[model samples]
Target: MNLKGVRTGIAAACAVVSLGAASSAAAQGQCSRDTLDDIAAKYVEGQKQGSIFTLPVGEWVDYRENGQLVSTATGVISQPSDFDWHLALVDTGTCHVLVHGVILKPVPYVVTTQLAWTFNGLGQIRSTVVREGDANFDAKKTYAYASKEDWSEIPAGKRDTRQALLALANAYLDRAGGGAADVALAPSCDRIDNGAYSTNCEPAPGAAFVDREFTVDEAKGAVAVVSNRGEAEGPQDSRIFRIEDGKIRHVHAVTPSQ
Candidate 1:
């Protein structure tokens, strides 16, 4: 299932709310990049230890100064889609929040099973938005909780990071081949062939061309797929994919410019 689109819509809503709100107090000092780095390091360690993998409830202090609301973080994670991670962050000082992440499942339904943070206290998350495979989303209806039994039933192969990467690539290829518009391909698929663009092929006036290459590093469990095509004119460039999934499902892509 593709959830990136839905996650993106929610992230955008969080941004609007964060920007509209006023900060409760000014930040005494800016958070150092090193501080963020340390926090990330610990976060990774916690994940590895399986100690901090569960989501938090109510309010929590992600960053603190004497525990006085220096900053707060709230977020949600989704599963079974293109977005491996979707996150939004709000700087309480300026009430500014930014959203970023990767999409893993991109077709039939986009799924963004990642994390997003909001700090301005204006950002709120409704995890029960809808069930994992529900085609329609009704705001008035409450979401049914996903039981542990349901989660355990998901096949391990479906949760494999490498498989997820390939699935995402194939989905993008399908979209490109289908003449779908506005769909972004991975940057790894972007390459030029003798002044000819590749990947993201669309039906041309006289000819239909689609061609590309992919490289998957098993050691690193990283996959890079590039698509390119040549027509009567020259060539067209496309996208790339950068995936990180080990045990639990996590996949993302970096655009050509990124």
Candidate 2:
């Protein structure tokens, strides 16, 4: 998996390339969160059928697998696979959704995908990063843990601000890279990478990260950060966070096994 698309979502995604996720997201206020969820669900179904044409990839599409440009007509999405389960993050502010799936049939694989959509009735899939036997990866365990995780929507009044959420995300990355961050962690914070898991993590500054693009779901104190998108092959890296009361509750990731 090319972690380069890690930065791709925030930096060079389809429509967000020119306008940036922040600017364009405001202008595309008409983008429907429910629609995004529906599209993502469709993508999950499409993958099982080995058909990329199932989704509304409008006009011109820019598809990539592990940072290497791919001919959308014949790429990973065209290959049918069985997934144990999948997790989807809908970022209405950025008009992009991050889809993370774990496959357990034939050979096991974990895939992280990001899709860019516009109100013009066009949905463009910009990145599809696949990981096979990455570090600490155990597809079955991941599926089991994911099923128990609570990602329910945070009540509107109880939600953390986007800026706060973003900071927490950066902090997690910082700590991951061995830096000192001043973010809070819940008493029972959980961290999952591939299938290996940990608990009660500390926070740090995310400056160790570069070329980062963030997909934030303010409604749920969740953020998915994809960094180093410019690299074709590095680490298939991604960090997802859920924070409440300024303390991180969960951290999720997909990276190289070796």
Candidate 3:
């Protein structure tokens, strides 16, 4: 099946998902860093049990799946199943979490999915975006980055400041696009492009990023940046950088479909 065609069809079903009208007063600044982690866990557990309605949600929840809008009562929630998330990067500052792994459901075929869940200060979920694709779309397979022992934490001597991490990640793009002559990369630097393994850090001409936006999680030692670079060319490209020992160890990229 043509995954691009499939994605297009889904995108046509765009609709906004809202729980209801906002309460007379909304909860503000109630979520802490640890609270975000709890919310993430609840999201995963709720999905696994096919009971997302039980979770705490804001008065208005905007959801998009595969570039298409989805409601709480439909899509993945409708066909609830088990999910094995390999890598999860949580940005506590922004209250956003990005997770990638395979969804184990018998009916619709097993596939890998990248999901970003955003939260509000009221301790409620505000937005969710999911991109689903089959194994063909997942190059590095699942858990390539998460399986590494030191992926979740950056040691004291290895941690880079937020500014430095952003620069290093951007430098990688510059070097990849030939704007820079040198870029720092770990000896075993590996890149997972759209769920597949790729030798992107090698000496070769690669696509340049455009309209880039970045978010850094210092505590997590991770950075999430998205831009337009692939053939489709929009804001659909995303890369998560795992910086370790002052070098980029792994990069998980989700590029747009052509």
On TM-score, the leading prediction is: 2
**lDDT, candidate 3, 138-247, per-residue tens:** 42353444455355666666678878888888887766656755667788887766556665555355677666556576766778765556334343456778787677
lDDT of 1 by residue, 71-159 (tens): 12222232223223333222222222222232223322211111222333322221111223443322111111111101122244433
Query: Against the correct fold, how does model 3 do in TM-score?
Result: 0.67
TM-score of each: 0.22, 0.78, 0.67
Worst 10 residues of 1 by lDDT: 142-151
Q: What is the lDDT of residue 122 in candidate 2?
A: 33
- Best-to-worst order by lDDT is 2, 3, 1
What lDDT score is found at residue 10 in candidate 1? 29
Query: Which regions of candidate 2 are displaced past 4 Å?
Result: 1-29, 119-130, 203-207, 229-236
* TM-score-superior candidate, 1 or 2: 2
What residue runs in model 1 are displaced by over 4 Å at the alpha carbon?
1-28, 53-258
| lDDT to native, each model | 0.29, 0.67, 0.52
lDDT of 3 at 99: 50
Give residue 129's error in model 1 in angstroms: 16
Which pairs of residues clash in candidate 3, taking residues 3 or more apart in a chain or in different chains?
A: 138-195, 139-195, 139-196, 139-197, 140-196, 140-197
Task: Please give, for residues 122-159, the per-residue lDDT of candidate 2 as tens digits.
Answer: 34454535455455778788878876888878989999
